[model samples]
Target chain A: MAGKKLSIIVFSGTVDKLMPVGILASGAAASGYEVNLFFTFWGLNAISKNGMQAQPQVDKNYEQMGPMMMKRMMDMKFPMWHQMVREAKEVGEVKVYACSTTMEFFGLKKEDLADFVDDVVGVATFLDRAEGGTTLFI
Target chain B: MSQEAKIAKTLDVKGMYCPGPVMETAKAIKQINVGEVLEVLATDPAAKPDIEAWARRTGHQILDIQQQGGVTRILVKRAK
Candidate 1:
């Protein structure tokens, strides 16, 4: 066993937060920790293969806050969020589980999602793996 | 220690989050070989948890880590 095994429960719909989830998981994979990331609710965007999307904070002013902000951040060398996720798969053995309950509601399947998903599991299955470890609700 | 022995390389990865720090650490660790070590400095607030997690899954050895000035410096040894 390592120092501590950690689990993160993601419930966000935006790809931005989901991107970080991958990065965090990647970092754990790199560090040699056992990380189980549970995707529930809107967090499934992380494994969406058809195309992942994120909406920036809308600027009500007469400025191009959305595009400008995105460009500025990109110009500043913010790594493409998706690249972090892709690299995570390459560098480590990460186990990504989708919420079976949520998938049932959405009528989604492993084949329907991107190739990154490890498996589809229910809350009890996730809890079984997450026993006696740190659980993060993101 | 060889003349070219690593004194220490502190990589500050604060604003860059998640895989950013993880990927950066990977590249940095790659530059050095087995004997040499890498000192990772991060301020992402999630660095400790993330790095510790990376260590467990990757089979790499972490020499030590210390926090000062709100930055955690992780010393990692590349495993053969």
Candidate 2:
């Protein structure tokens, strides 16, 4: 698994969708795989420094259950979604990338993103790094 | 039912979810020397299979695994 890669395109900003991105990235990293996360559209919101501190937003359909789920996770002392990705980075080769187009759309600069973000890149650059790897769009 | 190997570290990851146990195990194993044992105690129901998969992929050796009450005890030896 030396050269194995796991690439994820994060398109959703909801906590529900973001949870798996963190889990999968951590799991793959733990297994000695190279992990890449490409944040775009609403998903780019999550990497924003401010967004990282904001209250987690869930899908409208799960709005009622969101509070209960968050409570249970807190009671269990589970790490937040972004925290998991952070841990993955600490454990292995994990890179976080923000979409350049989305950055322009949201008027976000490199300084606006979380410190964990590696770079601001376009689709071509993302695809180049994601080539021949297992890519997931969330 | 037999004797267990001496453990170099004990990671108590109780109450964590799926990837937590595996991630902690990966990090914990690195802290120990090669051929040493790292014992992992987890409450997550998925810990057994998840850790097993992690060991298989990372080339670590699982010396033993036992489940009792709600906790799963996994003894993993660092292979590399």
Q: Pick the candidate with the highest lDDT.
A: 2
The local distance difference test score of each candidate is 0.69, 0.93
A10-119 in candidate 1: lDDT tens per residue?
A: 88755446556666776655655567878887676445554354353332552455576568667756655456556766665566788988777777778877676788
Q: How does the DockQ of candidate 2 come out?
A: 0.84
> Tens digits of per-residue lDDT for model 1 on B1-80?
22233534666686776567776787677677776678888877777776776666666677777787877878878775
Against the hidden true structure, what lDDT does model 1 obtain?
A: 0.69
Stretches off by above 4 angstroms in model 1 are A1-3, A51-69, B1-21, B27-33, B37-80
Q: Once model 1 is optimally superposed onto the true structure by TM-score, how far is the C-alpha of residue A134 displaced, in angstroms?
A: 1.4
Residue-wise C-alpha lDDT for candidate 2, range A1-138, written one tens digit per residue: 478899999999999999999999999999899999999998998889888889999999999999999999889888888999999999999999999999999999999999889999989989999999899999
Runs in model 2 deviating more than 4 A are B1-3
| CAPRI quality level assigned to candidate 2 from its DockQ score | high
